[model samples]
Target: MEFLQILDSDIRPGGLIEWIPAAPGGLGAWHRDPRGTSHNHEQHLRSAHDYRRATRREGGREAWLGLAVEFDQQIDFPAVQGALLAWINRHEVLRTHVRLDGPDVARYTTDPGTVLLRRSRIGWYHDPRLLIEQIAGSFDRATTPMHWPAYRFATVARAGSFTLFFAADHSLVDGYSLVNAQYELRELYQAARERRPAALPPTGSYVDFSSSERTAADAADDRHPAVAVWREFLGGADRLPPFGILPAPPTGAGPPPAQHSHTTLLLDDDATRALTDRATALGGSLIGALLAVAALVYHRHGGCRFTTLMPRHTRHHVEFHGALGWFVALAPISVDVSDDPDFALALERTMVSLDRAREGASLPMLRLAELIGIPPEPKFVVSFMDTRGVPGAVEADAGAAVALRSHTYADDEVYVWFNRTPGGLRLHSRFPAGGDGPGEAGLAAFLNEFAHLLASIAAGG
Candidate 1:
């Protein structure tokens, strides 16, 4: 799926139609679930910090993930409302509320039927740019980690078509859940129109997953192997891995630079398939080959080694795959490319580095941090997710699905994701903005090199 900002999105202007959740009734007192994990609690602190820092800086907001979808048919209010409410009821995570307790986060949940949405016609927008700015601001204010009902749903309605937008705090959802949500929501809307039950699989509750994981992780201590694995990976490094490819701003000259993003077409479908076969024939997987390509590029640019944190999902079962929640663990992967080895040897080192993933994601990042004495921010992440098998992601992307966590204000944070889409293998990165003009050009140059290296393997060079 293409994760993007609304500024990068293609949306038409229209009258706004929002199905807003009413004030939750019968909410039990916010009490800490001892079964709760530290992941969300840690994020709450980070969000608070980001919000305060962002208010002083320019365009940035706290962490929120979102998706924008298109509807080209005539409006159907009743069916749409039914579909939205049914969707909210189906996901137990949506039925809950969160608030910051003294030192921890507390949550209280209501039964399915209690959560209801009231329809409102917000306004009309003729200028698409103004509409975009308005929606982005609305989303930034709508979902906050410290508030109850941390998600909002709205549709920018047109004559015979509309674009539906949904935004939720990052603590409530992840990229996977947002991508799949398009499929489920459409099915629910159709079923609502027909007055039939939506044919959806039984989804496991993230609440239960959190409780079980919290209890299970309570057994971990300093002697745990994951602890050792994380401790070694960090090596007393506090901030994220440095960007040897880009120039850093003058030290202490000012606040950290704002961030920008770049996405490029690495290879077409035919070349991607050939490259996959080539990697297989070389006794290395596609992921390993891609990592080798990146390591080579990093080393070519006067780097000592290539190192990054990778995200691994905690959804071990099929059921959790369909749920909306932040269920992920971070693992460290570093490779010594200073030897200047060729693709074969680099792939070998890449494979060895990947072995770290097995243990790094085994524990929650918070627990890993407590074990290793490092905080969670300032992380340099490089992740590869082979999502070619995921049904409906292309359709969702066609409908303008965006991740919406952009407009960040970090100085040294960079996130890179390699996705195996149905079309081809592609990588997108968010790095230091470096004040815009030269930053964009430099990232493009860097990614072009990355693409050529992959193309070399695909063409048997």
Candidate 2:
């Protein structure tokens, strides 16, 4: 049995390595945090708790894997499980976690989560009635994170048999990882059931890549492009912008469900083609166009300019770029939403800024915080990514698949995020539930208007 090795992201080279044993019941998992020190760990947990507790003002609030196949032909559990494991093995990050203490301590995964191969009719019960109830139950009972750990997976019985699900802490994995895992699991399961050889790829270990990345970051004399982008865009703008998106709730109030619901906008082949063509014409990429609209929405909401933090994987150029460990650099960039008429040109500028931040990604988050004079806990953070890995490319499956989806917590003060999928582009905004911030309806309406404005831009309206 392979064991999952957990590591602390914040630990410098030659740090201490602490090993925690996994619990029984075939629920094999562990928590790998970015902060290795006791102080940072406590602070991170507190931040997560606060995020969950503050959801009532704007709306309601707070916030898996497995394999098994139907005995029948339709749902292939074995295949899916096999594929997922293969993918995990293929991606170095999934296989490794930060070791708390060690010389050059990095991601190591001797322990992989338990993989159960079982038969069930749970998946085949596509009856709308049963399906909806089961899904609802899963949603209701699923544990929302009170803290940020590595990743997690769970499954439950609905109606006749059982259904498997994956619940991972977002801080550890992103949307692309989940999708790839799913694909790998499916492939692995099918091959096993059929008694055929599984064709798994050769992926590097997360530890190797992470340590290498730190080395590269430290060695690079240049600042990450994203940070540079932020510095240039801010151009003397306030590092700490005013908090106007939502207000905090009064003390001693019970937590409420967050009002911010996520929605994905798929740009079909035609739409993707049209948007990309126009974007190129306007001197921007698809991401540039999306940023323009997002800026517009932010401007309309508060007339304030703020930084949008994006995660860039540093696994690149390392031996284990595809590995599953947290080797990402978060660069928070501010776009001057208050200026410029041509949204395209504005997006181009933002893109340029992103480049700078990436270049200087070797600077640790804590170091950046110190340099910027911002605490770990800031106002809501808005992130944007072009998710081309999952459900990306209309040509992949004839374009009928749902490409883009997002999960965000209003538990913290943060409100919105923007992303791109195969279908189109989506703007995911999370508003406060209680009195902590804005509600989903208001945020949605705001996005709707902004979308229309972008449409006009696309149509030259």
Candidate 3:
């Protein structure tokens, strides 16, 4: 699936339909003082960070995640509504909201079967630009970590087909959950129309995940092993290294420009196989090959050790495999590389470093941060996902499914995500572009050369 900020934001439009949570019979869904549940460490940390940074927000930093897909015909509104509610009830995280007041944050959850939604037609929109702006603005306004039901859904209908859009605050869901939502919704939609139970398995609740994770983290002290990994990684530095993909910013300049992303395919299916085999020969997996190349690129820029932030999914519970929640843990990964070594040798080192890194990923970064006495923020992130064999992956191959993110303000940090699918490996990067980085043509040239080098490796060079 092609993940875009606003799915096909440049395309034309016809009409718009918005779906938002409503009080059943206008009696308030979150009434009767919902029961408080344990908010995960990530959620509590996110709330505290937002509270600290709330005063400095500029141009409304919209930090929502979204997904948009199309169906051949107009939506069966009633059937879709039933399916949506069923899907929401299936994932308890969607039914929960954060209470950001008090000294510490808490989560209050509404029970299933008590929630309702309303469909409102906002008239026709022949202009695509205005339509996109309206949708994005709604998402920015509706989605905030501190609010209840921080999400929005809409339908953009055309002559014979229509697009379904769904967005939520990033705290409530991760990239994997956001992509899988469309698949689950479609399954429920079909069953709702057929008036039969969906042929899907039950999902575990994120509530339980939060409770268990928090209990374990609270018991961890500064002496914890994970805490030591983080302390060693950031002992004295205020923050991690900024991705040196672009020229350094002038010392006197203000904050760097807002982040921009570049997406490109790195290798094709055949090339991926060849490269995978090559990587296996060098180490034990493909990540070693990927990390080796990236470390070398930084090495060329005089970066001795490849250090960056990485995300590790906490999906150990098989039951939560299909559930939606922010079941992600962040960890720091660093590997040593040498200039004299061949690429194969570098991969060997990377493979060993990766195993050590895996063993170090015990607690969430925020919990580790609390142990290390630091703040949690983004800087020099490198993420990779192997999406070759997931359910509904075939549809993504055709590019119907996509994960979306809202506009974000940034300083000097850079983030790159690598996705491995049957089609190939794709790279998507977001970085400070104007104040410190290369211009339009310069960035394109850099990316083209980067892709070419990776392609050569894939070709067995």
Taking all chains together, each candidate's TM-score versus the true structure is: 0.91, 0.66, 0.89
Lowest lDDT sum, 10 consecutive residues, model 3, at 32-41
Each candidate: what lDDT? Answer: 0.73, 0.45, 0.70
What does candidate 3's lDDT look like per residue over 1-461, in tens digits? 66666723454487888889854543244544333333343454465456548656422246788888767766687877888889877987777766644565555667788778888898789878889888888888787665566788888888887777888876677777866787887788789989999878888887777778777877888777776676666653424432345455557545544567877788887888888898887655777778777766655545567777777778897898877887877766676654546678778877776666664577766666666664666567788887766677778657666777776556556677888876888888776666544544444554575567667888878
Per residue, candidate 1 scores C-alpha lDDT tens digits across 1-461 of: 67676666667888987777864444553334444644654565456646666556322254677877677777678888899899888998887765666666666777677877878887999988888888777777777665666778888887887777888877788777876787788788779989999999989888888777766766788887788777676673423333343445546656555567777657777998898888888788888888888888877766657777778778799889889888777777777877798998898888887886678678787776666775766357787776655567677545444555545556556778887777777677777666523455655666788888889888998
True-vs-predicted CA distance for residue 21, candidate 2, Å: 11
Arranged by TM-score with the best first, the candidates are 1, 3, 2
Best by TM-score: 1
Model 2 clashes, total count: 91
Query: How many backbone clashes does every candidate have?
Result: 0, 91, 0
Query: In terms of lDDT, which candidate is strongest?
Result: 1
lDDT of 3: 0.70
The candidate 2 region of ten consecutive residues with least summed lDDT is: 1-10
Candidate 1 structure, TM-score to reference: 0.91
Which scores better on TM-score, 2 or 3? 3
Per-residue lDDT of candidate 2, residues 1-461 (tens digit): 00001110011111111111233332235444342322222234344455556542211112222111212233344444554454444554444333323222222243454322332233434344554344333423332333112333333333343333444443344444443444444446567778787654555654554444445444533354434544453464645324344545547654444344544453444666677688788777776676666666666666556456565555555444334444455666656766644576567766775566565444555444544533565455555555556322333233212222223333445545555555455555555554554444555566677677776666655
